[model samples]
Target: MIRLGYPVVGVADLTVAAAFWTAALDLAESPEWARDSWRTLVRQTDGERVLGLMLSDSAPEQYPRIHLDLLVDTTAEQETEVERLIGLGAQRVDWDSYPPDPDFVVLADPDGNVFCVVDLSRAPSGS
Candidate 1:
């Protein structure tokens, strides 16, 4: 049976991207699969969920249709994590698509790849 693998992100510089993402996601580089142009980040507890960073010269998408959404338990946690990510080279995007009140905050990585930090506690039960 075919199963889903890790999500691969395009980056202009593997080292820089890997560094930022690994720290932001609290992941570690899998040395066994390490390469100059590619790197895999895995969670320490169980390496089931992984993120792959591949070197690319193309520019990042300003408005990517597909992006990662990081979930935090509480609004306070979400705010703290967003600030921490910014310190690690993430930029807060002045998103124009948000509703009057949004449960998620959009941020762009060092390479300008967009992602969101979400607080599900504030969302409706079925959302």
Candidate 2:
């Protein structure tokens, strides 16, 4: 049987990206996986590895084929979290392809990597 591994994100500056991600997601850096060009982040309370950041020189795509989607239980929480993330250096993206009643907001990390903050209470129909 095969198992799925955690997602790895490419970032131009690993230290800055690590700082933003660790604070934004309540994760902690994993020293065991530390390297000059890469860093692994784990859950703060459980030490379960959740994400990895790899050094990359290429620019982030305007429309990435894959991106992270963070979930919040309520619209209020989603709004609050989006603000909080912005306080931590995230920027709101002016997405052009939103549906009539979208359930997620687009945000870009400091490195310009785009992701979404989804409100589960308003998730798209049939999703």
Candidate 3:
């Protein structure tokens, strides 16, 4: 099987993006990188993998089509997080759920990268 790695995000300012993710995901920033341009973050509950965010000197001209879908414990908290992100320049493109879906919300990051806030209540525990 091919190894699919965690996505590394490119941001204008890693510090700002880091703060947004920390507050939104309740993740702790890792001090592995010596420079502010590169930073690591891991969730407190599961430290299996880390998400990397790097500072980009030039912004992406095209809309970022790919994004991370965060499985959330609570939709309410996720909503709050979404609001916080929107406050920090993240855009609200859409919020949608089909009949089969339990719960979820869609949002775009500051750079137009679209992602989903998914409710994990339906997932098998311990996954």
Candidate 4:
């Protein structure tokens, strides 16, 4: 009855976050980019529903218990991606929820919304 969709990460400045993600994921903003308050709303090449980088003026409390799962090929590669993300605008976080031998690294976006980069491992080597 319900279909999952791309996730949104709210931010204080859409343009800043959009710039970061455009570099991190090598994606470009949609032609429909609002150029205003919704400037951060972006679409991937696949035409997935726009992922929002909403302004902080929206609300408090992290919504929906959602975090974007960015898939990489290996944990070592994931580590490198984490470093790259840090260079982009991410901060490392202590995600106790994940396992010891994690296939991903948990981190927060520019606005502090958390997400994880997961390695596309054949076996569930880690949480």
User: In candidate 3, which residue ranges exceed 4 Å CA deviation?
Assistant: 1-4, 45-48, 57-65, 73-81, 84-89, 94-103, 120-127
Candidate 2 wrong stretches, greater than 4 Å: 125-127
For model 2, where is the 10-residue window of minimal lDDT? 118-127
Task: Give per-residue lDDT, candidate 2, residue 71.
Answer: 95
Tell how far residue 40 is off in model 4, in angstroms.
5.6
Determine the backbone clash count of candidate 3: 0
Q: What lDDT tens digits, residue by residue, belong to model 4 across residues 1-127? A: 9987566676787878888888888676775656566643444667555576656675423433766888898767887899999999898886667766666777887777778788887337466
What CA root-mean-square deviation does each model show from the true structure?
Answer: 1.4, 1.2, 4.9, 3.6
Each candidate's TM vs. the true structure? 0.93, 0.96, 0.64, 0.76
Q: Mind giving the per-residue lDDT tens digits that candidate 1 earns over 1-127?
A: 9988879999998888988988898898888678888888999779755899988889988889889999999999999999999999999998999987889999999999999999989877883
State, as a TM-score between 0 and 1, how close model 2 is to the true structure.
0.96
RMSD of 2: 1.2
RMSD of 4: 3.6
lDDT of 2 at 111: 98
lDDT of 4 at 78: 82
Q: Cα deviation of 72 in candidate 2 (Å)?
A: 0.1
lDDT of each: 0.90, 0.96, 0.70, 0.72
Q: Per-residue lDDT tens digits of candidate 2, residues 5-120?
A: 99999999999999999999999999977999999999999999999999999999889999999999999999999999999999999999889889999999999999999999
lDDT string, candidate 3, 1-127, tens digits? 8997668878887777887777766788876663857888887887645677888877653435676887767767777766776887677764434446546666766655566777766554674
